[model samples]
Target: MSNVINIWCIVRENRSVFSVTIGTNNNIFDLKVSIKDRRSNYFAKFDADDLTLWRVNIASSVLRNKDTAIEPYLNDKLEEPADTIGDTFHNVEGSNVRVVVEVPVTTASVENLANLFSQMNVSGSSASENASASPFTFFTELVKIAPNHVQKLYQDIIFEKITNPEYFLRNDKIQLGNFAPNGTASVYLRDNPTPTDTEDNVQNLFNDLMLSLPNFGKKLIVKDTHNNPYLDRLKPDLSVFLEEDVRDGTCIPMFVQTLLEVKKKKSESGLADEDKGQLIDYMNVLIQHQQLREHFALFLSDGFRFYVMVYERNNRQYKEFITNFITGLRLFYILLRYDSSYTKMADPRSIRFYKSPGTYTNIYLKEFLGLGTSSRVYKVDYNNTQAALKYTQSGNAHHEAQILRFLNENNVANIPNYITHDGHSIIISPVCKRIRNQFRAHHALQLLRLLSRIHSKRVFHRDVRPSNILLDINNDSVVLVDWGAAIRDPPNEQVLYEGTISFASPDILNNNLESHRPTATDDLHSFVRTMYILHNPSKMPIIPDGNLATKARVIREYWDDSVDVKLAGPLWEEMVNAAKNGDYGILEKCCSIFKS
Candidate 1:
């Protein structure tokens, strides 16, 4: 059981204080739900982990970095007793418990609120009172948000280290500074290299860039214990690994997080498809042994141009991001802005062009399974076992892991077991063969049973359509997959209508589902249409474009009782009526009809 605290938060919104009860365990997603329920429109969309009650309260001036203020009541519980939170607000019985929910970013509105809330701006406030402002709040308000500015600042600092390592060691607390605190910095450069020495220059430049990685207390910087036997494998030109066990007082050689392959500017032409393939192969080897590492960035650079492929081990997906040396230099610094987890995986890789019609060309190391809006599924042959991998191109919004984890926790059946999720990609149970035969009445019953099991656990497969419902031919079982569109059984307002328009419900197609909270009825509607299509493949009509109102009327007409006229047998007719009315009990009643 986790500890939780219920606190009345009086947030200043539109010159009025709106009071809401929030618990410690409630995340930003839950907060959004509460906001919608209260009909408050103060905050815009933000990441789930970004806005937390503990973080916001800690950054508040009233708290003054005091543990006694809120920490006494704070615990890791989903729901805690009222006594644990204490009866009074911060030891004051009648005091107003106020907390300003700052965005913590450089938004114009955030800055205005920061200035307004700053004790320094308040008249008659002493310096001692104003000093109560936490350093975290001040830093959040004043921190620069522009990427280019940050990169240039870091680039200059790293270049200074390259010019005079001793000066950098004495003056700054940058990358090598923390690890080698009392020691002098040794520049990894070949002495007195001439203008003709392109390889040496490239190596030196790469070394500087690697050392520029901000060392935030962890022993991320390590010397090249060159000539090591491990180098025999892959034999990258430059290999940088993060020491994960240093915090335990032991500097153990961990995963190789970054690998670089350098070629002379004159030999740039030598970089072909084979070089790229070799880099990917090296990454595959790293991924197998060093699965702990989030990203294994393989860079092939020819002093100027760079071709990089970052293998995200958790996601089990990789993407290529091409850039020149000049942009690459800035990119390295920008990469540090992300948590080691995200940066350790790879820089952003967008496949916008690949999303367009007829734009997909099979360029894969493993067998391509299928592609969705957010991920491309592939079948991989791994150590004599087969598994499916879903790779989401950078910046595409998807939360398949969250959905799968929920379903898994509830012990939902018929779906694939979640193997691993690496923020970007996911690997699941072995891919089953596609259903070659048209779905029959028996298949519809199996699907209904699967959906009933899923719904029993309070999960709605919002995208219940033919393409998403997979078939496990071995047991003739149906597996409903692509949990990307899955939502809690009751559904949340945030769960938007994301299914195919043709198969979408009349309410969804008409945009009439208030607050966008999808219901089991939506799934049933799609299922009814899916069964109709499977039963009458040749007779099914096409869904046209134009007016959505007209589209809704057409959808309603198609799903009416008369639509069952096209269904072949009595089992389908019963199933059709059940699905149209969102009655799942009929599935159990008709189970015997198909079992025979």
Candidate 2:
């Protein structure tokens, strides 16, 4: 009789549904072949010489080996088996044959088993019913993962889509309902209304419409409408709207159009009697529309009326002011792009226009002044003193504010004091005295010391240069600036290349080092360069001769000029002899040159 070789079968890393089978007479090699045959894509190729098989008991002790073919002895004790056994038989001669095979559980097998079970008509539902239930259950589960604000925003978008289905169907209308919850709305006006039914009237209409709706715990959105394509000669002015509270009941008002006050006044003054009569006729037709009456009600309210005005200033000057403001607030610009609802109404009372402030335009002190690429600096009087202001147009005003706060918290001396940010501009440390070159070395050294200290504290100044080092003349010391590129070392990953080119070491230039891992060696190189520039007016290191010379000559020239001034031309001959014989001992004789 053939000996039965019971074996355990296991499968791994499979994602599909399949079945596994085991036989009492199958060996480990036969099991592998059977599994491969069942799963056509799964093949196990093993070295025949290294193949070893062991039959393990419930306690993980080896019961049998393939090499040692032990025969079944009568009345031998069997190991404790799992509960899912197929059969146990007793022969007529009273011999027992027990078969046991273990099936291993795995992720793939579970998924496949699930798929197979799903296909079976076990009770009531078909496969299609089970499939349909998955999406609804998945969506319910997904809602748990969504953020509250995002969920609210999505609901607002859905509401808008439901209310204005035609707008989406038109294909030309840009759907802006998603952006409405942030307090603004955009609508494409198909036609411009009469003069009386202006943009302000339309805005008032939207305001009243929103006010009519229940509060619902969310802020109502203001609406604006512009002409479709917006390039036509009859370009419709955008109508903006806001809501108001009512005593007993709520009602919606139509949009009120805001016209340039100067143009309106000029038209009223220049009109002839007949033209005035025609204007009256046009006004009568506009006043009759229910949309116009609803909008006019909002115009009557103190907060909902809109008007446009212009100051008697040159357009160029106003443009320059706006440009300067935008340049100073670059971070804010970015913020606006990401989140566009931010708006600040300009106050005419606080406005001031100018050409340029010459004292603030010193090019050499650009870094110290925090003057950016635009080279324009604005000063606002705070507590009776002028403070320099830096603007970030990219909309990270809070980030800039946090950086300023960090500087202040550290009590870092010699740095320009951060004053305040007016949401659009950053007020920086004021310049106390006239800047000069005399403070360059001291400032550079102070900066170096600060950098070394920061590094000792595990900080790296990735952007170290003259521009980032500021001099406070009142204290006569230097303060390191531009923490934008500064970071903690080693573990912090540096993604961008930062720092000035001239002061950046060879490693930085070659992109050989990672960010936040700058060493003291690079700092030392920069310090030496700055010192050399300060000592020499030309700013380049003085090389005695243009050619590569002997070590003796190199030692004599680079060390001390005093030795050559005293000993005359005979040192050249000594250098030549040392070079010819490759004698370093003679070069050591010239060590006295550098001793001084």
Candidate 3:
């Protein structure tokens, strides 16, 4: 019969230590979780990784090697006979023997140990007598032998401090005085009797201590009626920290993380080959067409992930158009990913090619006509009002039609409305004449005001050039059209990629391959260019000649004396002189000449 020895396990870290005893037959793994359970907090701060266990020798006082193994006799149900043990048993030759087993505490290790303990059935009592022999029973008995309240408190406090300092601070009045009956600490808030400065002093000390700790700091709060600290809920004034760092820790970051995780999981799930092929086909279509770029770019969310692109359309080489096409696709995909229900198809038929028109069944079409890449424009009638309609053969007409329908549903004013469609994706609005004369600055300002209104609702008119802006003869108003690239600014960032080359901002041109962010500044730049075009009908602005180094540099040097200064020489001289002298005020003043 093998001798049965009672082994006491003590796990220590920092300022705390926990101990449990079990029959010698039980593996070291069994003790790890027992110590963790004894140390973990019930309400907060519970990581399995923090638990650690090791052995110490009672005599000669040295730690044992972690790999050392101890065997227990199966037949020996009781503790080893003290009188029968020899000198060799007490001291192994050339070996440093210890009482405890050293094992790194990890979730995996704890689980393995728990499994081993279950198999060994290392109960405090043997099965022979009137007692039950189970691993848990033994564990409970061992915990009672050397209870560790200090260790438990240390673990709880540290975990709470790291994982959720806010919660820890809020519950500061609560005193975790002692271990409860269940081997966990009981915490309760104390009511002040004398109302002394003790609490304040304690808080000050804690604050001072935390100041030296990394990623820990004190937050100011208002005092309540009982002189207790009340958390300040008011938003702080804009400061360096507020401007540079993230404020809300929950929603925006969580959403982005969730989106990335979802994509990763989907990829790992092994989507059907056919589905993958279809997505690839859609991406190919995005790569092939310029118009498709505008259509798809609107769908992307503020962040540049969740993208799409068309590679081929009608077997055409879409290389030249692919830049904008991929950008459009990325925008659209992001939008769909963020809020699929709002942006995705409510009816499958909406995606199919259909055309119809009638007064009673007229659909509000203003929202649907996104900016089209193609040059061709059409005319349609709705609600007895004629509207200019642009048609592009390269992109999704159904999506554009849906946008028009959405605009109507939301009752967005001044936008061309969409009518019914059965065979073709057609839109109807108040008919407008194209500005035969070159775009002027005043016209650009009027357009900017309209765009400002749209952007106030967080809508970005990605494509805003002279061609996209229409002049209504009946209303004598400049009606903005084409939302094909329109996008809603996300919570934290602005929309990207929605403009034409003639009025495209430097940022847009420099970041041409991907969807560069669209800003109010970009729109301002476009407006300025439009004004320049109207003033100088005989000549256009040219990008400065230089070996392009950086995007910012290219933009700064754009329109550097590449054109003949004589054709509209005065305006050219003013612009060149202002640019050469780095006088933005003069340049802006000159730009004002084209207004209206």
Candidate 4:
């Protein structure tokens, strides 16, 4: 499970005394392993496990209290062995089993030992036994001195001596002794079928991509790092910041402008709530601490579900810009290879949108949804009637694309019908406003029923205000618009509140940010507030200024008076009781308020 190994070694530089005791599988050796001086000579290679196996044969004999010199059997002697064994002791007293073996060492051997020991901090300068030091220090040191032929063997010796041999193995390679089918000591590359392998491979993939940024004509400094400031409160999986470089001929400086929070999942389960929250937290942090005015991107993936969001600093809102049900790796490739920019739809012209029966011509974005913004609400002629189309230059068309398809499949009520998307834009059937200014009690019930249907699917329209509520006078139909703030039931706490301050529930306005757990009750509260604003439009009061204290005072005063309104009778009574008790059954309680 853990990878680290320790070997006990002692070297007497001046006295030419070399002794090492390597333990593996309770096999300890007190034998002299000879070293010969050679500038160019080949030696056998052995990994730590192999060296341990080789030493097992000589372990029992050398375990005697007497000194034993293990002679070096070389194919051809390049030089003479330095010195024979002078003294050795096998003092197996306590757990601190002290053993010494005199190894024959030449001048070259002494040089290597000195170089290795100096690096290991175990040079013969100290008088006491070199205790508590790891054998890995020696192996790593020998890697510099040992030639290619014998480097692995020396490393193996170090591994055989250490406690966690696996930890000492190279990260690119994995020890397969435990996993070996034949019970033989074996090692393989790290591309195995394991969660750690998948996670590691994903990181390695990004690291490789980071190294290849120069190919993309981008001259920004890029790095793949972990555990950095993301909103200064949370640490995300990957944090990449891109900044423009300002060079003064002498000094080069970088101004960070773009921060991305990247999450990876092993499977295609889609982005989890926590992962979404991480990205939201990162965006919020940048806005709060850095006074972020420029747009930055946030990315999330579960290897299965992929999403990209752009934080619009002007409005302090995050808009879903892109998403895909495809593999995250493929989505990452698309992000890197494909450039992200808004398609100019402002220059309107006649175009045909391909639908089921035939192509719908005369499709054009008729009105600007937000002046100076890259979004528009278009009126299109289709199916011998008119439909409304909302198009955006930069937003997730694919997310709504999938949702509308699902709604059409199930024949859900009180929502727009899915038309088509042209990679960057989306079209849907629009719900026109009623001719009359006021919505009757039955209209309220229809809207409530729509809210219930949406909630049943675990979705919440976080922004439930008047402008977003649309009406069709012919059928007395209700259509909720502006799903940019829509989210699943378990809301990501990192996402800052994007709803209207005046209509926000008391708990939502003063809820604990640390535990950003948003339930259906928050939406229900906003729904109740919407009804009051709609019915008593004249009596409503605007909280002066955007100050937090003033907004809090306004929300408190409004809810206390409106929820106890006696003129509305049992309908208002049911709504008041629901709000007072924090109950989420608002639609059920007010069912008596509606009748055919």
Candidate 5:
């Protein structure tokens, strides 16, 4: 019990206190990971390994009460990765923050990068002339490496090998086998390559190649990685990492600046599907932890051939395909392409949003229905007519006003016949807050149709919960509200969280962040869960947790006699299957089940 301690840390940036329950025996690197995970969004672009932890000098200054500018006394730095927390810093029980964290600079946003690239504006002729002849089969247009940079790589690396052979041990490239592995041997051979001369030979070759490169030396080192920080069962052949970033608990992907992936010889499995998959998997983990849009990987397709792989992604947050909808995150590699390729609506700079005060000023607000930091909803008597009015700062991209305008234009049902909006909010005919304990089959069907209509317009309500859905008592339907988190066009990859977690889909909650996107199927899952929440208000979240297995079990066993389970239950199963298998056609059928 003495080994474990609760350490409170203060982030020097915003003076936010970060709490962690870790073992005193645990290294400094473990403590950093705990801090990062606790407030991932806050440090989305930061590498925790780069954070500077100082033993809080409570006797000098404090995080909240800035008595001194110089980072309080006792300024004893927790510098060594091998040193244990308890052995280094003395702990006080909530009397003062025991650790001070210094966050490094965050990476630039994708939009800013896009603007910079547009400013550079490479000519079409030069772009075509400079495109490299890539060895990977499916790889597309890659940004041409500058001739000087390419020359640097060749001179500093290739020439290093050519000139200094005696320093580097010689290996026979001819001895490297050219055997192509089919899927049958993939699982066994990849796991246990003890019998293969090729794998070990290639691994050594990869290590030597990275070691010889000018990019890696004393400050940077080459290593073969094993464990993952992001929970993906992936291991790179060799990772080029900053030596300072490596520790007993440090993960390679978190620190790896560039990774090396290799195959013995040119074969079906080499630069083709299998080898590329590993690189892509690693890219997912790296991008999540590194918070960067692009990374590079070194690929050795054969005994003597090496090619550079550039993994690039645009800023868009939803992915779509004509063939099938892959519900989770999917990345497409292309150089120079940005979110400019998507709809103007997805690009926020172009959207026209009314933010100033509206024309109508004569309004007597009676009762307050809801209130938040930037938003409020109230029952008001406006122009001598009773209306439910809501107002807030606009997040205009697929926002409440925008979505409502689109739905209104499309004539989607349950939208109020009379609705008015101006600067920041909307006024609509009063509707009941939500259906209480008596949620019905008819309401279920109406909710299904409402969501179907929204999806039909390519508008997905990222947050679909009971509060966001109001009952149209007179019409026996529902009005879907709160469109601030909605998105339109699909993207190649998305890295932001836009919706509530408990009602989130398996893809969002699955811990493996390889896939994090909003989908029509995500809505279906939320839609079904919303019905359950409506029927049983006491059992709040319905699922109550985001653990994948437990959520599945809870969803599977959930049955309510209050609503028509025969219609809703089968619909849920079909929708869930569609999400997993990319069978979106089944979604229409899933909705039709409510009609049946």
Candidate 6:
């Protein structure tokens, strides 16, 4: 029965929204009263009952940000008097705001119109006289402002605790002495300054200001991040941290007090997502990495203009503050006093390249050694140590890492040595080579033995293709790789198709409906199919015409053809026929298949 749980109500004709809290049983009219109460200044002449309300129903994905006009998107009207607040808005996919009430202009009364027009040029005396009594005149005046000024009026609202509630902003004139009372500051002017000049010049100007403002409150240390990279080569222009928090070069997210990004002009907001989006990237470092702190101040500036925004560690709630350059520095001073006295994170044994839910390879830009439909394998050289790094932009990295760690813990043989993993990359030692037609009968036997050991642990390497079978001839290693598709003792259910179709088990790939559960038998069956095909690719299993009934015929003919030439022992024939004909005896004898 919850209603408007921390949802914002976007009033009409305003650039922003104010948060609304309503009772579960509250109807559409109650929502209107709530909006009018908060915006009483704008709704002075209009009674709460007179205000019209609507229900904004839009997908969360399209909730535009930062003063986006909401008129066109507002199509749903709250005409139902019986519709409770909860029933009005669906919390579908974490909606951002309830853009409900829009302000309606109250037509000025005859006396109020006289008062307003009198001020229009009639006289200052008549304006001062009627202004106090004429609320309609005030509403009329607000209506005359441009849309951008309305944006300014709404941008002033922010979440409590992020800023002082008494803090107010307007397009009021600012005095130069507010920033530099002594004389014209160097930051105000530059020698032939261009768009690029703003970034460095502002950094230098801040450094100069810090030098003269020592102990004005507390000592603050600022580091220029122009050259220092963070979170894998991504860095903000400036970061403030204690000297001790500065490790080898990494900026611990929990310790960074404040961040600033400088842009030359605000119009750069049009050139890509440079303006606000750049601030978000810096915040992402903290929000995605750490869990300790609740909030931090990220300041954005365009030389003379300043902006403030607060995003929690989870980034669910957002608030922005706008001010002139000197006032923005005041906000920076507020950041300096932030209770960064939180506990630090302890060091861990294994390094975390990135956290789970992070499945992109944006951190790496090196050339890859191998590519596949869903993954890329890179040859990385880190501190004289070489390893093959596998990148899959999905949970597959975690899945494969889990299986490799399990098998590695059991001292399983022939699998690549497990190195640490983070992000979408899993590093394994001894880069192995792929085979086209080089697979041997003895190699097939060795792989069967490998799968035997894997199956003994009740783990199924469902994908037994040649590409996943790695060979390091000089090192005498026959390894198995790419365990992402492996299912670990899954229940007997319809097995959806996984792994390369060419090398996958016919039990999985051949069925018209492909309805079968995962089992150790499937791996053994897949291994037999792969071995027959790997020895001679010209003769391979084919689902001719994709007919379910004819699939067994083609498989039988393919396996019989391989067996006719004595490709290997009776194992390939028995294994394929056993799977093709639903023979389960071969599943029990897989350990000794090649041994026979």
Best by lDDT: 6
lDDT of 2 at 271: 21
Per-residue lDDT of 215-258 in model 5, one digit per residue for the tens? 21136555666334222345666665446546553543334555
Candidate 6 CA-lDDT value: 0.53
Which parts of model 5 are misplaced by more than 4 Å? Answer: 1-362, 371-374, 393-398, 416-418, 511-515, 536-538, 541-575, 578-596
lDDT for each residue of candidate 3 in 128-183, tens digit (9 for 90 to 100): 21121111101100111011222332222111112221221232333212223332
- The whole-model lDDT of each prediction reads 0.46, 0.31, 0.34, 0.41, 0.47, 0.53
| Least well predicted 10-residue stretch by lDDT in candidate 1 | 132-141
Give the least accurate 10-residue stretch of model 5, judged by summed lDDT. 133-142
Model 1 ranges with Cα > 4 A deviation: 1-364, 382-384, 394-398, 438-442, 489-495, 510-515, 539-576, 588-596
| The candidate that achieves the highest TM-score relative to the unseen native structure | 1
Model 6 residue 306 CA deviation (Å) reads: 2.0
lDDT digits (tens) for residues 1-596 of candidate 4: 22222323222121222234323222222122322111012212322211211111123333342332222111111122222122122323222213222322211222233233222121110111221111101010111112222223222221112223232123325331222333211121133221234555655554554453323234443444444422233444554332322222111101233333444564445554444444544454343322213454556653334565455545544455334423323333333332322100113433445443464444643222211023445455555556666555555566656766765676777776777775445667753652124466666776677776777777766656555566765677776655544565455555444334445566655641112355566667667766655543323344444445555565566556443232234565567568546555564554333333
TM-score of 6: 0.35
lDDT of 2 by residue, 188-292 (tens): 111222233354554454344333333323222333323321111112222222233111222111112221110121232232223222212222222221111
Error of 6 at 400 (Å): 13
**Cα error of candidate 1 at position 28, Å:** 65
Clashes per model (N, Cα, C within 3 A): 8, 44, 62, 14, 3, 3
TM-score of model number 2: 0.28
Better candidate by TM-score, 1 or 5: 1
TM-score of each: 0.36, 0.28, 0.31, 0.35, 0.33, 0.35
Q: After superposition, how far is residue 60 of candidate 6 from its true place, in Å?
A: 27
